[model samples]
Target: MATAKKLPSGSYRVRVYDKVTGKYRSFTAPTKREAEHKAAEFLRYRVDTRDTRLTVREVCQRYINERSNVLSPASIDRYQRILDKQLSEDFKDTYLEKLSESIITDEVNRLCGKYTPKTVKTTVHFFLPIIRKHRRDLELDDIRLPKVFPKVKEYPEPAVIMQLFRGDRMELEVLLALCYGLRKEEIRGLRSSDLSGNVLTIRRVMIDVGRTSVVRENAAKTVNSIRSITVAPFVADLIQARSGDYVTSMSGQAIYKHFSRVMAKAGYSITFHDLRHINASVMLYLGVPDKYAMERGGWATDNTLKKVYQSTFSDQRKRFDDMVDNYFSKIYDTNI
Candidate 1:
């Protein structure tokens, strides 16, 4: 407790007992009210300083260090970025005991607004294992996250894609994404030695993990992702002709920017990742079976290939409808 006293100089002074120093600490303010407020704030700071066991930032670092062995390098990198760049300063400095449901939900909503739903969900996932590890202190059920709505992806027509390949500098880059369904990181990670016998092995992935833009080479996203992919005859020829350590000298960011520019010149706007969707959709359109398509694309699960990647074009569906109508008409005429 602090006591305020009126001073001869016309200002009020508050004196608080300093337990550690075994002395009274005094502060002067213009008025008794100001003196009291200042003293109370100082007392609160002291209490907070003494009570803090661990900060959110410390917990995040601890989580990353403890789980580094189990988590993928990409996952570890993402968690580090979330803690460094995404989380609020107040949220990062907050003590574990002081964290509340309102605080967590507010931050989640803010993060969802800034990034994609999938990104938000993944970022929030880092908190779960950490909170559970301290279950004796925090109630995991207290924090509830908002639902992440799935987004509908758009892809360009096959003909339009073919037109863009006409002597474009990025033709090879575009072809790799559309023809092989390789991720941009996978493309950057490709080495010349990985290609042989018309098959390319996905052994490494290059990612910009932190704020510094320092790219890191790590293992593929999953064991299935590390499998080999066989290319078409033309693609195999293209790889054989290349004389470099990597498929391209361009960085991952450069590849994406150049690809976007090429697509824009062709009068369409789609991301490089959307090319993966284009590849899968074309395979489905060509009547390729799910198992073979899944194998070629290195998808461990068919649900994503069937639902997320496979999309039917309206023109293709119309053609099927016309064929069905013609068949039914011919059968009825024969009976007549």
Candidate 2:
């Protein structure tokens, strides 16, 4: 339901109302013709009052339910994490009207205080569009995305990461991650049957429940994550030696709790994710192609691969020397 009213002052006021909103938000325009135009837009954004109090959690969950099937499992997992572990908590009980920019910025800042800018940015990114979508549904306008946060350049050296790998409860998990670059959930969810012929088929992942943060065995992060990796001989031996009935099964909390202890106890100033970065960097250094590394890594973008993971290798370092020797050898050898 919408209408345009002519204010005595000359500007036209366009107003729209829906059962969802219970009342109309009027848009004032400078002319009658403009009022008609604005009225149409107002009608497009008019929300029903039955739904006036849209909560972030509700909208995000609905969005996940209706749209997530189209996304790869890995991507779905990442989105779920940003929402459940971060967004859901901040906006758990908030209404869309109550969710102002100040609150969002402050909450994100607190999250950034604990995580890297890259991580905080991801967290913000996952929710911004969804929030904007809801705002549009409510007829809000000019919604914008926030700036990407910057990450610290400093990190622990590989030697330090290796030191964090101890031979104990979490040692095997960290070893699998470092050697194979499997995600933490991937490392924790391996079943004995999934391993054979020196290959491990990653078929499942565990994630925190949207509301509770409790890990549950569901589908793997993405269909692609349900992949096979040839285990290094050492890793194969380590898998064989384990006494557990399943090769890779454990509660998600186990990895989190232990990794935290190991990092704190070892003073290894790095995140668990650094293991993946170290692995990808090492593989590129060993002459693996970008495609191979990206496929093996379940990575989503080349920039992330090239900028974040790729480390220049010997080939690049020695290209000039090798080319000079091979292509100009005759010139160097000439008597003149």
Task: Per model, state how many residue pairs clash.
Answer: 0, 12
lDDT tens digits by residue: candidate 2, 1-336: 355677889788876664454766677888877877776766666544344377777777777777766764556767767777775365656777677766666676677677766777677777777776556553224333345655564555544554546456565677677666788877766767778966677776645444333333445655445556666555666788777756655556667666767777766556677778877766665666565556566664545434423443345523422332232223222412
Query: For residue 71, what is the lDDT in candidate 2?
Result: 64
lDDT of 1 by residue, 116-153 (tens): 77777787887756644443344457655557776675
True-vs-predicted CA distance for residue 295, candidate 1, Å:
1.3
Best by TM-score: 1
Full-model lDDT for every candidate: 0.68, 0.62
TM-score of each: 0.67, 0.58
Model 2 bad stretches (over 4 Å): 1-39, 53-148, 153-166, 210-218, 248-250, 264-266, 300-336
Which candidate has the highest lDDT of all?
1
What are the runs in model 1 whose C-alpha is more than 4 Å off? 1-52, 112-115, 135-142, 211-218, 301-336
lDDT measured at residue 44 in model 2 versus the true structure, 0 to 100: 64
